[model samples]
Structure formats: C-alpha cells, structure tokens
Target chain A: MHMADALVSPAVAGAMYAASTAAAAYSVKRVKHEDDIKKIPLMGVMGAFVFTAQMINFTIPGTGSSGHLCGGVMATALLGPYAGFLTMIGVLLIQCLLFADGGLLALGCNVWNMAFYGCFVGYYLIWRPMTRRRLSGGRILAGSLIASMLTLQLGAFSVAVETLLSGVTKLPFSAFVAVMQPIHLAIGFVEGAITAAVLLFVYQARPELLDDKGKSGRQNRFSYKRTIAVLGVFAVITGAGLSLAASSYPDGLEWSIQQVAKAEEIEAEGGGVYAAAEGIQSATSLLPDYAFPESENRMGTSCSGIVGAVFVLALCVGVCYAIRFWGKKRIK
Target chain B: MSKIEGAVRELHRVDSIAGADRWIHRIYPSVKLILTVFYIAFVVSYGKYQLPRLILMGVYPIVIFILGDLSFFDALRRLRFILPFVCAAGIFNPLFDRKILFYAGEIGITGGMVSMAALLIKGVYSVLASYLLIATTPVEKICFSLRKMHVPAVFVTQLLLTYRYISVLLEEAQRMAQAYALRSPGQKGVHFKVWGSFAGQLLLRSADRASRVYDSMLMRGYQGEFSCAAVSKCRQRDIGYLLVWLAAFVALRIG
Candidate 1:
C-alpha cells in the first residue's frame, strides 16, 4: 500500500526516511562489494520491468476485479535482497516523480512497506525457508504465495500503525486496522498467486537464474540475525527519540493519545503506574488541556483569520500573474 | 492494454512539462527539490484544527502553478485517482471528533469538521508541491542533483537507467498484453493458468534484454562510472530562489 504524505506526520516520515536511506546505503555497499558490474544493467532493466508489470493487471477469479504484480519478492528471488531493494527504490522514485503514484515525503514509508518487507522479510523468512532444501514447482508456488501474503500483511499493518501515529485522521486505531487488514489480505492473496505463477514460470524456463547454489558463500556470510538485531535496535532508538520529540512538540502522537483517551472511557485506577504516566503526560504536554485559552472575541478572531487567508491567497495569485505578465511584456 | 498505454502517455506528459521553458523549470533542480520538501513539511506541521493556517499554505502551490505556466485543471485531472483516496482518508474525522470548535453564522463547527478540512488541504497541498517539483525538474536533472548531494553513484545510475528503459519495456508489455487479450476473448485478463507463461515470458525477455544492454555498455567502455554531460552550478538566482522560498516557508509556519 502506498502511503500518502497526509497519512504520515513529519516525525514518522523523517524516521522512515532515515531508516530507508540507511537501508539503501547499506544495499548500495553490499551490491558494490559483490563487484559484479553486470548487475547494474540487470537491476535497472528489472526495475523498469517491475514498473511496466505493475501496469498490467490480471483479474482475480470470480472477483470481477483485478490486481497487478508488486514484484518485490519476485525481484528479490531473481536478484538478491540487496539489489532487489535498490531496484525497488528506483521504481518507486520514478513512480513518485513521473506519475505521483505516491507522495515524495511518504516515499520512504512506501518503500519500507512495499519493498523492505517483501525484499528482506519475504525473502529470508518465507521464500528462502520454503525453497531452501530444493527447487520444485510446489516450493516455488508456496514460497511466493506465503512470502507475498505475509509481507503484504506486515505492510498493511504498518500503514495502519503509521496512520494512527500520525493523528491526522480521527480513525480509531482498531477501526483503521479492521478495515486495512482484510482488504490487504485479499490483495495479498492475488499478489501471491501472481508472484507464484511468474516465479514458477521463470524456474522452468531458466532454472539457472533461480539457482542460488553458486552464491551460497556470499549469501551465508550475510547473517540475517545480526542485521535484524541491528535494525531492531535502531528502530527502538528512533522510536524513543521520536516519541520524546513528539511529546515536546505536541504532535500527532499526543493528539492521537488524546483522541483515544476521549474515545475510550478508562477509569482512573489509583495505581502508581497510572499516576506516574498521567504526571508525565501532563508535564510533557505543551497544551495541558489541548486547547487555547478562550477569548471573548473568539468568533471575531476566527472570522478575521478566514478573511486574512482569502486575502493572502488573492494577493499571491495577483502577484504571480502580474510577474508573468510583466516578464512577457519585457520580452516583447 | 489501455492501462499500459495510458501510463506511458502520462509519463511522457510529465517529461514534456518538465522540459518546458519556464522560470520555474530554469531554477536549479536541487533547489526546487529542497523547497518542495520544505513546503510539504511546513504544510503538514500545522495542527489538525489549524484550518486557517492550512488554507494559507495553498498560496505556494497556486503561485507555482501560475508561474510555471501550468494548468490547475490539468494537474487536478492528473491527480484525479489519488485525490479521492486522500479525501477518503479523512472522511471519518467528522464522525470521530464531534467537539464543537467554533460557530459559523449559527452553524456550529466541530473540531472533527475543521480537522477533516485541514487534513484534506494538507493532502492536496503536499501532493501539489510534489507535482510542482517533478513538473519543473527533469528526472535526469533530479538524479544529477541527487548525485551532487552525495547519493551513491550506483543508486543514481540505476534510477537513470530505469527511467530510460521504462518506455521500452512498457511498449513490449503492451504488445504482449494485446496479444493475450486478443487470444482470450471475453476473458477479463490472462487466465491464472497462463499467468506464469504470460509474465514469465516477459521476465525472460527482460532478462535477455538486460544482458544485451550490459554487453552494449561494456562495448562502449563502461566501467561502472557515469558522467553527466551538463553540470548545473548553483547560480546566485538559484540561491535567491531558495532563500526567498525558505523565508516564505518560515513566515508561513510562524506567522
């Protein structure tokens, strides 16, 4: 799922951008270390292939609707995770700029959701495990299906969490999750089936491409556990840091908690933990009551604000056209 | 098949617009890129109830659209697919938030309604800001700027190559899709049974094309290093543009 800029707060967006950029840098280093210059063109072409492939939709049986290829797991299957992730970055960048399929600010989140999970988690956890012992028709199909579905599930869940954290929407967390997950489950199934079909076909046509026997040495040296541990720590640190930043700034996180607090009637338990947390929240809240001081002339001020906004917009348009007109006259 | 063709046409439209001769297009690509990011951040940073301030942020895109000599309707038309999703994202706001914020001529304005409007404006503003950046800056120049900003060469190279070849692959896919559609009359898409062969054939062909592309690169004495023909220096005007936009953004955020 492509997250729009509206769905993410600056804090969440910045954290995601940092995470995805780090991943891209790491992928670049890994790909360079391989020293196989041949992969550059292949990655490029495959990136384009994924781009075009996404445009070609196939109808799901009995659904009357259609789905297209996501191509993360499929790309990683052909190219390793590192290259696949980078290729995805390329495809997504083009999509953002050329078609505006996803927003630029949200590109980081989109990449992590669509690419990181599929390329890394889908590959290491599901695809590799399913096809580890040997390559077979059933293994290829099962691996693609499971990997696609699992990754889509993770991606969809992340989207729900991110939107909730952003607080731009009034959607309750449970309600948002309830809607996002099932829809993606269906999408994931279709994606999985298509991925399976493609991978199986490639396996039959050029089995050598799917064979990882030759690259086992390089692949084994890269420990998934160590990478995951490092990433886990990074995420934790970023989360804590962002939460602190968000608290001081009174951002979406605080707003969301307030919304949740209002929506759910929680009895104030006379417990040490509850008291301490409440104390912390009040201490950290920029607006302790989450509203500005009421003024007798509040209506007047709001009316003035709206009037000023309209005036500013008019002035902006006037200046723009004025300058354009002036420039054309000067040229003439 | 029409979807593929439509996408290719959209890509060309953006490319052609980016290549247009206009003051916005003439500015340094990196400057436009940075300003767009700043503008989006500024718009998104406002509180959900800050509808007035959010409305003020509309000035940036409106001015850019006029100065760039672009049609607002065309831009909106291009964004038709995404605008609905953005709007729908905040549709539940009014329901979840019912606290009255203000009164408008005997009608009470709830916080939810205000926030929903704010969110919709934020989405529109952010999308427009991004569209402006790409509409003004060519993809090549954008990549070049990325390289200058210390983005890795490998990634930049991949971006350029992928951009270059997207049309080629899209055409091939279109042809293949047409053939399939013709063969499977009344079918919605290629049958699931033939998906493997359909997409598989495309994949195999793409791989073969990649091999040939690599061969051509090697023959041209490519050694993994890409050189740009034109190097864009940050002129004084570009700096002025950046400073002006930064000042405006700061003023908007604080004013």
Candidate 2:
C-alpha cells in the first residue's frame, strides 16, 4: 500500500504532507509532555526491531507464499499511539530512503495510510476498547487481529482514493476500489493473524507490557474529542486548499469526480454552493479544459520538443563525462 | 534468511558509498534534498500524455549518477523489486484508455500507450531522484538537514537512533534466524505455530537491550536532544548549485 510519487499529483501530495505534518507535530508534543526520556531509546530500538522483523518472513499455512509483520498494531499495543506513530514514521522514512520501498514525495500519503490508521484508529477504536478493563489471551489475539485487518482496509481504501484523486491513472474509481479492497482483505487477514500471534506471545510473557496504563505507569490521558477536533480543522483546511488548487488543474480531482459520477451536467444547472464554486473555478482556471492555447502546427511543435529533449539529454551526458575526465586529470 | 542478509549488506553498501568524496557528494545535503523533491514534483506535475517533457526530466538523475561516480545498473538492481510494482500499477492504463492519440506512420498510437509510457518514466525518475539523494548523503547528515529545517527534535532523534540501531538489530535477528534454522531444518520459514515464541523471544530480548542502551546513554549524560560537532555551513557554491538547479527545473517545466 506504499504510494509511489508517480501515482499522486502535487496538490494531493501537498495536502497530505500538511495533514501528516500536523499529526506528527501533535504526536511529538504529546510524547514530549509525557517526559519519559527512556522512551527515546526504546522507540528507536523498537522501530529497528520492527524493521528487522519485517525482513524475517514466515510461511503461511497451506499456502506456498510467506508473509511478514507490519508491526503497526503491535507497536501501538506496546508503546501506545503517540510513540507508536512516531516509531512507524521512523521505520517508513528509513525504508523510503534506503530501500525505495516508497517514494519520498509520497511519504505523507504512505505515513497517513500505513502509520496513521494503525496507530491512531486501530488503537483508539479496536485495541484500547477491547483490552480496556481486563487483559486476557483471547482479548490480545482478537484485538490484534481486528485492529490489523481494519487498519489495513482503511489504508488500502485511502490508497485507492488518493490514486484516483491524483488522476494520473486511467482506472475508474469503482474498478480501482473493487480491485484494491479484496486483495488487501487477504493481505490484511495474514497481517492480522501474525500480529495476533506476536501480541499473544508478549501477553503471556510480560503481561505488564500489555497493561492499559502503558509502560510509564501513568494513565493514557489522550482525549479523543480534542484529537478529532484538531484533525477536523486540518481536514477542512486541506479540503479547501485542494479545491482551490484543483480548480486551476481540472484534470485531477475534478476529472475523477466527473468520471465517477458521470455528472458533468449537474454542476452546469446547480445553484448555491455548486454555482459559487463553479464561478470560482472558472475564474481561476488558466487552462479551462487542460488544453494549451491553440497551436497552428501541433505536430511541428511536438517534433521540436522531442528533438530538444534529446539534445538536452545528450548535453547532460557530455557534461558528466567531461567532469569525470577533468577529475581524473587532476588526480593524476 | 538470505533476504535478511542481503538487505543488511545492501544498507551497508549504500552507506559506504555515501561516504565517498565526490563533487555531488560534497554539495550541501539540504540543497540536494530540496532539489530531489523539486525534481520529483516537476516530473509528477506534468500532464499524463506529456511523455516528451517527462523524458526530459531524466537528465537530472543521469547527470547526478555520473557526477557522483555511481553505477546506473547498481541503482536499477536496487530498484528491481519496486520498479515492477510501479509498472504493474500503470499496466491497466493501456486497457482503460484506448482513445487513439496520434499516428506513427500508419499505426495509431492510443492515449493509453502514451500515458502508460509517461507513468513508467515518471516512476523511474522519481525513484532515481530519491535513491540518488540518499546515495550521496549519509543518514546523519540528512537528519541534521531535517533538524535544520525545523523538523522537531524528538522525531529527528528517533530517526537517527533508529538508523543507528538497525544494523545492530539486523545482526541479532540474523543470528536468531540462523539458530532457528539449525534447530528446524527443512522448514521454509519460521512456522506459524512457533511465530509466537520465535518473534516473542526476539521482542523480549530487544526490549531488554533497549533498556540497557538507555542506561548507557544516561551514563553519558544523555539529554533529550542531540548536538553535532561538525556543523555544515552553506557555501557560495551551494547557493549557486541551488539556483542553477532551480532554474533548470523551471526551464524544463516551462519547455
């Protein structure tokens, strides 16, 4: 579910970056307020542990293929959400830079998809509630399984939505969602099972680690309402900013909506909000239909553009070789 | 097991190569980071059918590879796993979009074909830009640049520590895997039945090690933040490099 830079437009990427940055900032603040200096090294080591764990693949029963741990739910279960989210960010960033597992520009989307859902939504909704009053083997297993599957589904759905909104692909929204959701369901199941196994082991070995108060022995006082309010404001800002940006580039979100609804004419006759937005869109649209100003000789322009591109590539290669040659002479 | 070993070696290879002294490597880390981001943005911002313009963006990576004394084939080899997935994502483009875009001789090229080609180019270019940045800059320097950019100290501290400990943990995991394989031969991977004990044991060991690590840091008067001795100042050439790349990116976008 790692999004490549090619799959997202700048507008969508920028909006996601803003959202992820806000989330990260909030998480850092919360972690700092806790003031557990020991968590610093623990978060780092655990992040590395997750990284190593992923490389150790396990064989699936009755299937020829193998699966590995995602560790988002496990991290959250052990470290709580704030620290877990930051640890996942560390893991994802290293993967992006070292292995190219995901793209740098698309890091925001990947973080939101992989880290945000599992750390925040999985913890608050599934893991916390399930393990709230008591700790049991069955609760640990069930919580890990449910949280993992649900978060993976959300992450997969977000990927589909992001790709569609980017409008770089020709995939229809329904078809993309249809294809993405089911494959992830299987992947999610495997992830859930493995997460359950790992968490179950920890539960038996060191039950204190799985306690609701977390490792610091303090109550987890993170407020759901406050978080939601902050994130809601971010969502509103991102939505408005994207809408304004999408107006100028009609081929992105606008194109996706048109394709999905097949309702290009609805906005043509609508009043109120639609009419006002349409007015703003038309006013801001530089290339109304994503077409350049009329060119008399289109083929001629294309031919020249191709030639210019080839010339520039050749020039780049030539300069590179020249630099290498000069460096060799200096060394000699 | 081999996968784990290969990954460890791959990380070392990239890290070692990044220490090489070269013109591109000598350029400021933050500047290269910004340029890489801009390069990717420019490549992605192009229209779907704009294959020619997209192809032109390839120059940045190609020049950087040569100047950095890096191998293009090595980069491609590193990207082998991801490139296929990237291609697979766009493979449906040709099927969904069949509008005939232009004619080549008597053959009618569809919009799908052009966009598919454009997507492939975009993927390769973006991946290369990121790989090149990390290939040239060390992880610590990159983290330093991130801190300089006002990314929170806690996150930067986490990133540095995680990177530092990754090699240690990989070694430990490899040793454990070797032990597991020796005990259970003919097993494809650690069985699902033993996953609890196998991974759980590792997790327990890791937590213990982390506690000891924290103790050692505290002994060294560890604070919540890290300070670096070799502070990199932006040179005149760094500014020139930034301006030149910015101009080139702008020109390519306009052209």
Candidate 3:
C-alpha cells in the first residue's frame, strides 16, 4: 500500500517534508538521549532486522499480492516509545533509498504516518501495559491486533487529512475516512498477526533476549534529554522553514475526483465527449483516498506552505501528548 | 603531518566511507535530498495536461544519469532490480486509468497512458538521482553531514553500527543457508519450517551479540558523535558542480 508520487501535490508534499524533517531531527535527539549510548546499536539492530524481515515475503492467500511485514509495530514491541520511533526512521530511510519501496519526496509522510503511530502510540497505549511484568500470549495477541489496527487507521486518516488540507482531495472528510480506515484495518490485522507470530516464536525459544537487553542497561536503551534537544532543534527548523514554502493547490487524487464528480453533476463542466470516460476511473478509485487532491487553480503556494509546516508540527505535538495520555490511563 | 594523515586515512578506510575513492563521492547527502525533492516537486506541479513540461522533466534526470560518471552500461545494469517495481506500478496505471483526457487521432487509449508515463518518469528520475547520490557520496560522509546538521548523536551512531553489523548477520544467514543446502540439497532444501526456525535462531543470536558489542562500544567512549570528516576544503571548481545544477533547476522551473 505505498503512496505514489503522482498521488501527492507539491503543497502537501512540502508540508509533509517539513513535518518529517522535524520528526527526524526529533528522533535523532530521542535516540542518543543523554548518555545511554547503547541505544545506538539497538536502533541499528532493529533497523537491520526489520530490513531483512521485509525482504522475506509471505503469501497473502487468494489475493496473491505477497505483502511483507512493515516492521514498525514489531519495532515498537521490541523497543520503547522513543527508541522505537528512531529505529523506524532508519528503516524507512533505508527502504526508500536502497530498496525503492516508497518515494523520495513522499518519504517524510510515509515514515511519519507508518512509524510515528506504530512506534509511540502502539507501544505506550497497548503493548506496554499488557506485556508489563507477566507476559501472556493472549495479551500479546489482543494488544497487537488493536494497536496495529489503530495505528493504520490513524495513518490512513492522516493521509486523508494531509490531502484535504493541501487541497488535493474533493471528497468530504467523513466519506474519505470511512473508505480509508476499514481497508487499512484489514491490512493492519494481518500485519499484527504476523508480528505476534514472530515475537511468539522468539518468546517460546528465548525470553531471555528481553532480559539481556534490560541488563545491558543504561547503555542499551536511549538517552531522553539530549535526544529530545537535538530532535527539537531540527523539528523547529523544518516546521518554520517548510511553513514558509508550502503551496496552495489541492492534492492529486482530490483534484481528479472532484473534477470528475463535478463534470458528472453538471452536463457541461468540461463540456466535452471525454466527460463520461472520466467518470469510469473516478468511480473505481472511489475509496476515500481516491479523493487525493492536487490543488490546480490556486494563487499562492506560499501561504499553504506556511500552513503545512505549522499544521504538521502541531499535529506531531498532538500525537505525542495523545500517546502519553493514552499510556498513563492504560498502564497500571 | 604525513604520519597523522595516513593514520586518519587508514582509520577512515577501515570504518566509514567504504571504497569512496571517487569524485562524485564528495557531494553532501542533504544537498542530494534537497535537489531530489525540488526535482520531483517541479515534475508533479505541471497540470496533468502539460505534456511538454512532463517530457522535459523526465529528460533532466537522464542527463544526470549520463553525467554521474558510472559506466553507462553498468548503470543500466544496476536498474535491472529496480525496473520490476516501476514496471509493476506503471503497468497497472493504464489498465485502471482509462479516462480519455486526450485523444490521439483515432485508435483509442486511456489517459492512463500518460499517467503510466508519468509514474515511470517519476520512478526513473528519483531512482537515477539516488543512484548518483549513493554511488558518489560515501555513506560515512553523509552521516558526517547529518552530524553537522545536528542529527541526534544516537541515530547517526546507529546507522553506522547497523551498517557494520549487516555484514556480520548477513554472513551468519548465508552460512546457515549454506549448511541447510548441504544437509538437504534438493526440494527439501528450501523447506519453510527449516528456514523459518533458522531465521528465528539467527535473529535472537544477533540481538544478543549486538547488545554486547554496543556495551563495549559505550565503554570505549563513543559519545554518539563521529569526528566529522575533514572533506578537502571546498575549491572554486566545486562551484561548477553546485551552480550547474542550481541553474538547471531554475531554468526548468521557470521555462
């Protein structure tokens, strides 16, 4: 389910870039974190493991779309919130450049949506509480299912929101969310099962791995203070600079859907014979995300640029606080 | 002076910037990343209706591909692995996108043709840009730039360590596969159960070893920051490299 470059607009792309840069900077800060230098290997190892795992594909039954594990959720399960996020950044960056799985311009969005939620929220809210002292297979299974689904849902929704704000999509918010959330929900379910399987296998053979990491102690996990500072500085620059350069047009899919829908509604929207032909593809891309918007007729790309940066940073802050709140309430 | 430079050179060869004894290896990754973004941004901005702009955008990267200094034939060979995904994604575009945005005289085809072409260009252009960047820049220099840019000390450290360990784990996986091949040697050789269990075991072992290695690294005063590479002082000639591209981007954007 990779988002294509053709699917994103410049405004949305810029904004996401700003947001992602901030997140990346924040992640670097999050990982090195005050002196617990051991997290370095933790991040690298997890990234490598995830990369290898992704290379090993699994069949998807009748669909025949042999999808591999995304590894974000699994990373969260193994690493704590902050470190998990950093590892994912590594994985996504590597995947984009070396493997060519996702787009360069779209990398920021993909990493943030897939990694951010899967790492922080998935861990603190679901995995941590359930897996806390006495781990249960049942708890792991249930937590994995819920957390994975929720993470995908948020990611899908974020794509929708970004598209809309960038003015790319023509679909109403509710309809778009309805279409995106459920499909991603199915994908997330399958992903969680695989993650649980991998971990369960490890647990059965060697629960000592966790103990080993824990004993590796202050060196292994990450330093919070310094990581946050470094990340915070980058995020600030990205958020500020990106905000200044964003475009005003609607995003890609949004523009097409809106145009086709408008043409169908009015007999002479484009007033051409090709009008009916446009309807067919528009009808098929009916998934809420079909509303991907590329703003075509906008005047100022600059104002939207500023808005994109501001909104992404604000959204990230919202997610951080939301996960913290979720963890506090859920964990004993 | 000569003694210190030699030691540093040896240390660099042994650790970061693996085999980066070429000219293209000197460009900064952030510069590459910036240019790639700007390139894609310009490509996607043209209304789907603008054919000339689209075609022109597609050509710019091809020029870079030629200039990137890699053997033309070898460069194309590198694209063999990449071609499949681009083909897969593009193949679907025309089939799914039958909207006749424009008609080519008589025999009918969908706008998906243009969309497919667009997707292919986007794919090829970005891939070419990245190939140029990675092939030229030593991974270490990029990490070093990241450090100067204040990327968290930990993230940068992990990228380097993870790269180091990839060889270690890959060797282990390779050996395990070899042993498996020797044991079964036939259809049974590729059994999922055997490979699955083997991968699982390797994973746990690697994790444990990595943790140990990390602990020792910490003991050795690795405070997460690498000494930024002393790139040869930027010469006036370097302006030719940076400016030529900047000029190209502006010309493309406004033209």
Candidate 4:
C-alpha cells in the first residue's frame, strides 16, 4: 500500500525524503556515468511499460479484490538496478502527481520503500543470483516470487515503521505490522508471479535484453550482504527509538489537551498578556458559554455551537464564492 | 468507470486542467511544487487530535480549487479510492484507543475517535493539496522546474519521456485488451492465465519500439542529454507566489 502523507510525521517524512533523494542522486550519477545512449531510451520505455502494465488490474482469487502490477522487480530484472531505480522513480512520480496515488511528502517514503528496495536490494540479493547464466522458467519464477515478496515485505514494513515513527496513528507497532505484513505478502506474491511470468516471456522471446547489464551479480553480492546487514541494524535502532517515544507520549489528542490545560493553569497562576486576552474573550462572550442563550444541557450547548460553526462556515464559503465571481469579472 | 477508462480520463483531466491560465496555474512550477510540499508537511505536522486546527488548512485546497478552476466534487471523487486504506488503518483506532477523553451527551468520545478524526482530516487535506499541484501545473513544466532545481538531467529526461509515453503505451494496452475481449466474449478484463503473456507481449513490443526510437534519435544527431522546449524563468509573480505560500504555511504550522 502507498503510504499516505497523513500517515507520516514531518520528521519521518523529511528523513525519508533525504534518504530517497540521496539514493536517487546516486542512481542518476551511476546512470549518467555510464552515459549509454542506447540504455537511455530503454529506461524511458521500460518506465512506460511498467506504468501501462500497472493499469491492467487483475482480480485476486477468493477475495474478489483487484490488484495491479508494481513492476519494480520486473524493471530491475530487465534493466539492472541503477537504471531500474531511476525508472521506478519516474513511474512513481507520475503516479503521485498525475494519478494522486500518494501525496508529495509521502512520495519520498514511497520511492524508498517501493523503488529503492525493489531495484537495489531485490536486484542484488535475489533476482541476480537466481537468474545467473540459466534462463529456466523455474529459476525465474522462484527468483521473482522470493525477490518481489522480500521487497514488498520490506516496503510494507518500512511504511509501518514510518507511521510508528510519525506516531500519528494509534496503531500499535505490533498491530500495524500484523495487519500490513500479511496483506502485502499476498500482494507481493501476485506481483512476483506476474514479474516472473513477464520476465520469463521476455527472456524466451529475446534473451539479450534480460542478460546484458546484469552481468556482475556475483561481484555485487558481497557488498549487498553488508548493505542488508547495515539496514537491519538501522531498522532496529529507529524502531526502538520511535516506539519508546510513541509509548511515552499519550495519543496526540490527549497530549495537546494536557499541554493546553497546563498552559491555562500557568496563565491563571500568573498575569500579563494572558489577562488581556482573557479580558477580550470575556468581553466578546455574548452567551458566556460560546453557545445559545437558552441552551441548558451540555448536549444543547454542543449542538448550538455546531450550528453556529456551520453558519460561519457557510458564510465563509459564500464570501469566497463572491470574491471568485468578483475576481473573474474584474479580470474580464 | 472501468479502471482503464478512469485511468485515461484522469490522465486527460489533469493535463487539461494544467493547461488553464489562471493565477494559480500561471505561478511558477517550482513555486507551486514547494508550496504543495510545504502545505502537506504543515497539515501533517499536527498532532492526531488537532482535528479542528487541521480543518483550518482546508482553506488552501478550497482556495486552490476556486482559483485553479478545478471541480471541487470531482477532486473529492478522485480521492474516494484511497479512503479504504485510510479507513482500514483508522477503523482500529477506536478499537485500540478506548480511553474516554470527553463526552457528548451519553456518548463518550474516546482518544481513538479523536485521533481517527485527526488522521482522516490529515489524509484528506494532504491528498487535496497534492491534487491541486497536479491540477494546476503540467508535467512538462514540473520537469522543467525539477531541472531548474538542480535535479539530475538524466533523471528528469526519464521522467519527461516516461510521462510522454504513458498515454501512448496505455492506448496500446487498451487496444490489446479490446482485441482480447472481442475474441473472448463474456470475459471481464484479461483473464489471469493470459496476463503473463499479455504483459510479456506488451513489453516485447515496447522494447522493439524503443530500439527503433533510439535509431531515430541517432539519425537526428542524438545527444546524451535530452533538452526541453520550455524555458524556465522565475518572474516577479513567481517569487510572490513562493513567499505568500511559504508565509501562509509557516503561519499554519505555528498557529
């Protein structure tokens, strides 16, 4: 699932944006350093290939829900990881901006979770090893399934951790993990199967396209092992750090209320600008209850307050509309 | 709408809206991009219980809808698909966070309910703000802005080319689906068994097309860097756009 902007805190979102931007910049450098003009068109076309393929949603069995292709594993398989990473970024950016699939802040999270893992980690760790020298269907199938599933699991878990770090949702880390992991596992399997099938077909139809740049999978395997190890440690540190903060902070609503209440108590104990603000508030207290004059019960007061709020909202909307009309007339 | 048809319509709708020349639309793409990011971050920075304050951020999207000449209801409708994910995650809030924070009549409004409201509001406002960005700025202009912002040229070129070819490849996919539908009457979308082959064939076809495109590029004195037709210049209005949105966003965040 694409992580929505609301799911992340500014800190988590900013951190992710930085991470993804660095990774993207590295990918761009690698792609640029190569400067292979032939591969440039391949990158663009393959991105579009993934985008179009993603549109053809397939009905998942038994659940009746439809799922589409992610295309990351497949893109990585076809165009080595660096180029693959760039392509996935392009696809996701278009999806975020044009389709509104995800928000701008969360785009960083999406790119890292979806593209970075699928291209770099999945490519080196799983797909490369499985498809070495042999173009067999079984190898392709097994590779895609494992790689796609791994990337998706990592992506989904990252989303869970992001929300945990954001601490915006009341979803406990365990519960979020429990819910996110299994669903993505299923999606990952389906996407992996599709990725395998397509890659297998492409390999059979034209083997050269699949085999060219993915030549040094063995050389990179060593580095990836260390990369994966480092990532594991990083995850643990962040997860522990964030969960600690999450547990200590009461839910956002209560925390804010406590802060406000604490501030008000302090204001009452002292006196200054607070007294002036209180004087003004008291002066404008028409009903002395921020509600209707005849309202007796708490429910009545709340209802009247709601009515007044709606009235003010309507007035605001009317004024905006009037301004728009006036602005259009003046422009004409 | 069928998923494919809806995808096509969405692609066209944003492209058409971005072509509009209103004040919001005319604002520099980089300025709009920065504002969109700032607005979303501001909306999301609030605590989950800050629903009322979060609601105030609705003015940004509402004002955008009016100025950008976007259809409000249509924008909301486009967001409907994302609701299920938000709801699935949010539905558990009330179940998990049962500490009663306050009460309205006999009903106790728990922390879960308040946080859930905050989550939903955050999701809606952020999504709407992003929708406005795309609705007002064309993809080409966005790529130009990204380039101007010092994004790597190769990456930007890929983005531009990929966007340009999405519609073309989608049409190709549409044709393929139609042909398959005509032959396999009473079938809904391409059958699962055919998906692999169908997607494989599409990839193969596109790969061939890409090579042909490369050949054409070579014939036309191909350069490594792809150049854009549009010149990106930040006029005075663009600076004003950036400053005003940044100020508004900062105010929202602090207030």
What would the per-residue lDDT of candidate 2 be over residues A311-330, giving only the tens digit for each residue?
Answer: 76898899999988898999
Candidate 4, residues A121-210: lDDT per residue as tens digits?
887788877777676888888999999999999999998888777876666889889988998999999998778778878878887887
Instruction: Evaluate model 4: give its lDDT.
Output: 0.78
Q: Among the candidates, what TM-score does chain A have in each?
A: 0.82, 0.80, 0.60, 0.79
* Candidate 3 per-residue lDDT over residues B101-215, each given as its tens digit: 5333464545566556655655566665655555556666667666767776677777766665655655565566556658765432234343335556767876887788877
Query: For all the predictions, what are the DockQ values?
Result: 0.59, 0.59, 0.15, 0.53
Kindly give the stretch of ten consecutive residues in candidate 4 chain A with the minimal lDDT sum. A214-223
Name the docking class for model 3. incorrect
Residue A194, candidate 2: alpha-carbon lDDT: 85
Error of 1 at B152 (Å): 0.6
What C-alpha lDDT, on a 0 to 100 scale, does residue B254 get in candidate 3?
Answer: 42
Error of 1 at B83 (Å): 2.5
Better of 1 and 3 by TM-score: 1
CA displacement after TM-score superposition, residue A84 of candidate 3 (Å) = 1.2
Per-chain TM-score of candidate 1, chain B:
0.96
Return the candidate ranking by lDDT, descending.
Answer: 2, 1, 4, 3
Candidate 2: the clashing residue pairs are: none
